[model samples]
Target: MTSSVLEAQKLGRKYGRRWALRDCTIEIPSGHVVGLVGPNGAGKTTLLKLASGQLEATEGAVTVLGDRPAATPARLARIGFVAQDTPVYSGLSIADHLRLGARLNPRWDAAMAQERIARLGLAPDQRAGKLSGGQRAQVALTLGLAKRPELLILDEPVAALDPLARREFMQGLMEATVEHEFSVVLSSHLVSDLERVCDFLVVLVDSRVQVAGETDKLLATHYRLTGPRRDTDRLPADQQVISASHTDRQSTFVVRTDSPIHDPAWTVTQLNLEDLVLAYMDKHTADRRAALEVQR
Candidate 1:
C-alpha cells in the first residue's frame, strides 16, 4: 500500500468575493506519477502553487512530508517544482543555469545534471534566452530532476512544446520515474498526455475535487448504462447516477458502484479516461444550468 506524501484538509483559496478553490481535500501518495487536470479557469495551477508552497491557502491546511509546506526548509529541499511557462533566467546560458542550480540547491547532483544535458543533446553554452521554447523547458526539467527530490511537481510542463518535443519530454519523465523511486505530479489540460504517462489522476472541476484515486480502479469501477427512458422515479434505488441523457424510449447514464450489476434490460459499457473526464465535466455543466434556472 502506498503512503501519502502530501495531504490537504478543507483546502481553499479566495480572492475578494470569488473562491478560487474551496473545500478541496486530497491525499497524494508517494512514488507514483499523478496527473492534475481541469479546464481553463479551473484552479489547477492554484492547487499546484499551494502544494509547492508558492501560494498560501485561504483556509484549512496542507502538509508536505507531514510538515507544513511553508518554511519547512528540509521538506522544501526534498521537493522540486517546474512551474508553468518553464521559468528560466533569460540571459543565462544552459551551463550557467546548471551551475546556479548546483550552487543553490543543497542536494544538487552535478553528474546527474550533466548526464541529462548529454541525453537531451543540448549544447551547454547555448543561452537559455536563445534556445527555442521547447529547449528551455528541457533545461528547466533537467534542473528539477537533478535536485534529487523525493517529490517533483510540474505545472503544464509540456503545454508549449511541439508534438515531437512533447513526446520526448514525456518519455524522459517516464524513464526518470522507472530509474529512480521519486514521485511526480504534473498538471496539463491535454488529456492524451495524462492517459499516456499517469497511473493516478486527480480531476478538479470548478475549483473543487471531482475525483482522486488509482487510475485503473476509476476506469474499472465506472460504467455507462443504457435502458428504457424513465423519469427520476424509475431509476433503481441502488444505482448512483453520475450523469444522464435520455430520449422517450431510452436513457443512458454514467454510474459508480463496486457491486456487480446484472440487469437484463440495461447495457453497460466501460469508460475510457477521456470518456470519464467528459462525464464529470458534463455533471458540472448540468449543475450550472440548474443553478441558473433556480435564479430565474
Candidate 2:
C-alpha cells in the first residue's frame, strides 16, 4: 500500500485564457478523511476531477496510489469518484443502478450494496427520480462505496441537502469509512460539515492552496493576539501574520508560529478551525488587493 493516497507537484489546469487551478501542490496521506474547503470558484471541482482522471492537468504531475491517476483499468478500479450534486440516473430504479455498477466495476460487492440499501430502508424497485434529495445522495454514495476503492473522492456531496439530511448523510459516510478503512477526500464550501468529519484539511483560495495540514496541528500553531496598536513590521520574525485588523487604539492579529509566545503586551488565544481557515482566506484577499493597487 502507498503511504500517500494522492500526490501532486505544482499541478495546474487551464481553459482558454483563464487558469482554473494553478501552482497547486498537495500530498494526502493514507487513512485520512481530508476535507477540501474553499469558497465557490476556488477550483475544488477542477482539482478533484484531475485526481479522478476525468480531466488532465495542463501542467505539473499528479499520482494516485503511486501511479498516474486513471492510468489503467486496474488503476481506475482502485479510485472512486462521486461528482458534485450527487447525480443519479432519473430513469433507473435502485436495483437497476446496482446492476449497472456490478457490470462496470470488477470489484463490485453486490451483497454489501444490497445490504446498504436495505439498511437505508430503500426499496429496490423505487425509481431514483422519485427519491428525496437525501435518499438520492445516499444512493449515489452506496454506488461509490460498493466499488470498494482504496480512495474515494467526493465533491460537495451534501451541498444540496437540508440540515437534517446533511447530518444523516455525513453520519452514514463516517460509519462506512470506519467499516471499509478507505481514504477519502471530500470537498465542500461549508466549514461546519468538514469540522464534524475531517481529521485533515486543505484550504484553497484564488485557484491556489492557501493552507494544508492536519487539523489539530493547524489549530495548535495558529493564535489570535489582541494588543495596543502596533505595526505588523515590529512583530518578531518567527510570527507570520495571517490576518490583521486595527481599531483606533487596539489591534488584533491571527498569527502562525511554532514557538511559544512570551510577549507580555499581547494576550494570545487559540483559534478554532473556522477562525484559522478564514484568516488564511482574508490574507489571500488582502494580498490580491495590494497587488492590484501596485499595478494601478
Candidate 3:
C-alpha cells in the first residue's frame, strides 16, 4: 500500500560495544525484489532483523509498509520473515507446521498452503526433520507465503542448499512473488543468485550501506575504466572512484558518474551487477584499510 516497502533513516543496532549495523539508511520502493548483498558481518542480517521487528534499533528508525515494523498484530500480519537456515521444528510434521501457522496468523490461507505443499510433492505427514534442506526451506517459504503478507523478508534462505536446490528454491520464490504480487527483501552472499532474482540492489559493508539503487541504474552509471597509469587525483572530480588498482604502465578504476566519459586516453566498459556490487564493497574495504594505516 505504501510507496516504499521498507524505509530506514540512520538505522543502527548495537550489541554492547559492537555495532552490527550503523547509519544504514535505505528506502526500498514497493513492487520490487530487492537484493541485500554484502560480505560476512556486513550487517545484512541485522538490518533484516530490524526490518522484521525481531530486534530493535539502537539509533534512528525503520518503517515497514508505512508503519513502525510489527507495531501491532495487524501490522505484524502484513510482514512475513523467513530467517536464515529456514528454521522449522524438526519434530513437527509438514501438516503440523501449516496448522501452527493457521493458528498464529489470522490471515493465513490454509487452502493455499495445502495446495502449495501438494504441488511441491511434499507429504503432509512428512516430518520436517526427515526432509532435505531444500524441502525444509520450501516448507518455511510456504508458511511465509501463505500468511499473504504485503512484504516478505528472507535472509539467506538457500545458503545451505546445493547448486540445484538453491536454483529450485529461488525459482519457486520468484514464481510465488509473481503470483502473490508482494514486495520482497532478500539478503544473500551469492551475488550471482541475487543478480538473477533481484531488480533492485543494496550493498552493505562494514556496518554501513555502501550503495543502493535499481540494478539497471547502478550498472549503467558505474563504469570500469582502464588507462595509462595515473593517480586518482588526476581524474575528473565528477567521476567518484569506487575502487582502483594500478600497475607500472596501466591503471583501472571503477567509478560512478552520470556524465559520459569522452576522454580518449581511457577505455570505459559497463559493469555487471556482481561487479558493481563488488566494486562498492571493495571500496569500503579499501577505505577502512586506508583509515587504519593513517592511525598506525
Candidate 2 lDDT over residue span 162-207, tens digit each: 9998998899899999998899999999898899899999999977
Candidate that beats the other on TM-score, 1 or 2, i.e. the better one:
2
Best prediction by lDDT: 2
Report the number of clashing residue pairs per model: 0, 0, 0
Judging by lDDT, tell me the better candidate of 2 and 3.
2
| Candidate 3 per-residue lDDT over residues 127-222, each given as its tens digit | 999999999999999999999999999999989999888898899999999888999999998798888899899888876778989888898899
- Residue-level lDDT of model 1, residues 1-296, one tens digit each, is 37787788989999888888888888888767999888887888888888889889999898876678875667678889999989899899999999999988899989989999988889999889988888888899999999889889999999988998898889988998898789899998888878989999888887777888888998988989888886655667776777999998999999887887798888989999988888888888898899999999
Q: RMSD in Å for candidate 1, one decimal?
A: 1.9
- Clashing pairs in model 2, backbone N/Cα/C closer than 3 A: none
Candidate 3 worst ten-residue window by lDDT: 67-76
**Over all chains combined, what TM-score does candidate 3 have?**
0.95
Ranking of models by lDDT: 2, 3, 1
lDDT of 3: 0.92
CA-only RMSD, every prediction: 1.9, 1.5, 1.6
